[model samples]
Target: MLGLRILVHSIKLVVRNWRVALRISSPLIAVLLVFGVFMRGSIAGVATLGPDEGVSWLAIGVYLIAQTFSGTWVAVAWHRYVLQEDDSGAIIPSFMGRRVGAYFMQGVLIAIIVGIVTVVAAAALFFAFSGLNSLVLAIVLPLVIALVGLWLFYRVSPALPAVAIEEALSIGDAWRATRPYSGSILVLVIAMAAASGVFGALVELTVESSTYLYLVLVMVQTWISMMVGISVLTTIYGVVVENRDF
Candidate 1:
């Protein structure tokens, strides 16, 4: 029930803030689509790569930069908007500033931490149960580890909104604050993963029909996933950090 509430509230936050949301997201979404179109070949090639094959570092770097910038820009703006913390009072959100930079850096740090934790957990589980592994276990183990990493990520994500609002929250602070709510956050993560998987399965069902339709659905899903993911983090931050009513 807690997870369901988080999911519903996150969607509502996006819906209620639709005007400012669209205003800030439009230009960045255009940029992302244009970038995707230009990099379509390389992006598509990623899925077809052999075990020994690798993508070009340059292409990967460019794509990551574009995605990270666009994502952080929208997140910072949305956080400020929802918290009533931004005094910019502009029609659209700001793209360049200290807040975005700090958010980006902190994001990178969090990614590193999550990656390290995931790797360590996977390794530990692999070695500890080396002789008991089955085909199903092989497939499930990594997925479980990834989900654990995501749960940990959410537990520490309040620092992001704190950064946006210039509240000086450390990563440790965020983690400690949400310690008791770990189970709730895990529930939220599972619910989100289930929802995304369902949406993706439906989209896959349309892939055989029309390429245009598949592309449109993919873009829409991507946009919704991005916004809701940010909103979830923002909601968690509000409830935990600001003691906002859930």
Candidate 2:
């Protein structure tokens, strides 16, 4: 249950330091809000559709790029604020261009690794399940495949916060560090997936009620998700890498 303990503790880190978390993320939140308006429909499960935010391909592209920058910046800043407790105390977190670039690079590397692993896992699982052809299997197979990916991602995600803190850690290194926590991580992956799916469905029901409310809920969810995600990586890095106790 180490992973569950870590998840709960990580959440407390964000909640206890909620003000600083907001300060670290607020600038990027503003940036995302501005560019987010132009994004239409759901982009990776979070809805961005709005009253006048029509379908613009160019706007979507720009918004995605802006989102990347803003996300990286906030993640790096938050890691520092959590680990280093940086003393600037400014309204917005300090900008670190090189760290942001490095963070993006590491993210792309992780994505590629995760993508390949997921694809291979999918192919294998598809072959394994192909002969069954039951309706229940059809519904459950994708969930199983997705859990595989999430499990793998959690195993190596320590690399992300390492990059944020200017530490060098390869995917292989992170994978090795997390070896003992395999069972816990799998349980954590399942719990996280279930929670996210339930929350996303709850928010999706609001889409037709009021566009503004939908937009607000979606952004708020994204904001909290991002912070909690960063905290998770930070927690993992602290526990397995730095040998810090919660």
Candidate 3:
């Protein structure tokens, strides 16, 4: 019930603060547009990368780096807007230097932990079912690993919001904060994914099959999805960790 309320509240918050949301999300949307343009060219030329593929690879790498930086900045800005109750600022703040670095490091650490869990689970499954048919093992192992990864991701997701708020939180703290709401968290994740999937499907069914149109729709969907995600996470952190009302 609380999870449902949180999700509803998130949507309401976005609707009520659409202007602020747009400001916070503009940089990310811009970055997505640039990324889509470059990626389209890269994908179109991928088949012809016979001799001089260095420039293409470099462009891809640069896009990845820019995307990462922009993503982190947007996240931090949203966090600030939510936690600090500040609604008047540039879309991207001018002085998120150390904060960005800290958030990036926290992200890296979380990824490492999730990766370790995945590898360990895979190893355990392999050894525990050595006698099983190879085909069964091959099919089941990946599914099991994916499930475990999703669970792990939900477990630590609150940490990102905590990092955004400069909450002096550790992974263990986040894990503990969300432990009681694990089931709610799982439901929230599924609900969000299903909503996004359905929206994307609708867009695909209705829109003409133009690459540029697809990219534009994707970028718009991504921005809205990200804003909702940020709102959800911030709300969850407030309710669970801070014991406050949304």
Candidate 4:
């Protein structure tokens, strides 16, 4: 019940401060728009050359690098603004340097660790259940793996806010800080996922079949979701780690 309250409070916080959310997200929106308009054609051209082609690989690399930097910038900015009450806007000139790189590297490190663990667990399950029905294994195993991944992610998520504030936090520190609130974190994660899924379904059902329109709607949905996620995590971090009142 406490977890639910925190989730509700987080949602209210984001909705109540919509202007701040928009200002913080504006830089990301602008960057995405520019990339879509200027680089999409070139990337698409390279993609048409087939997956095995050198130009295709180049395009993928470029896209990934751009996404990593842009995503890190947005996440760090949101964390700083919401968690620290830093009034600095989305495009803080000073944040574009080492701070952005540190944030990006931290994310990459966490992702790599989570990916490895998930892969290893799935492989173990496959071998251990060699005699299980193939269809059941195929469907159930992936869901189980996904749940485990989500659990692991929540365990270390506190480190992300730590990085945002330039704090020296290890994975162990984050894991332990969140241990007391694990139940609440689980509820929040599941609730957020369900909400996002429903929102996407509604968009699919009501929107016209125009590619550009769909893309725009999806981007908007993503931004809103991002804001909610940051808010929830920041709130949790403040309450659990810093002993701050909600």
Question: TM-score for every candidate vs. truth?
Answer: 0.88, 0.90, 0.79, 0.81
Question: Global lDDT of each model?
Answer: 0.79, 0.80, 0.74, 0.71
- List where candidate 4 sits over 4 angstroms from the true fold: 35-64, 89-96, 206-208
Question: lDDT by residue for model 2 over 1-246, one digit each (tens)?
Answer: 887888888889889999888888976688657754644343422254422345456655666677778889999998888777764788888899998899899889888989898999888988877888587477888888889988998899888888888888898999999998889889888877777789889988997897767777877777887888888888888888899998
Best by lDDT: 2
Off by over 4 Å in 2: 36-53, 134-137
After TM-score superposition, the amount by which residue 218's alpha carbon in candidate 2 deviates from its true location, in angstroms, is 0.7
Model 1, runs deviating above 4 Å: 36-61, 85-91
User: Could you tell me the lDDT of residue 79 within candidate 4?
Assistant: 78
Q: Given candidate 4, what's the lDDT at residue 134?
A: 92
Question: Which of 2 and 4 is ahead in lDDT?
Answer: 2
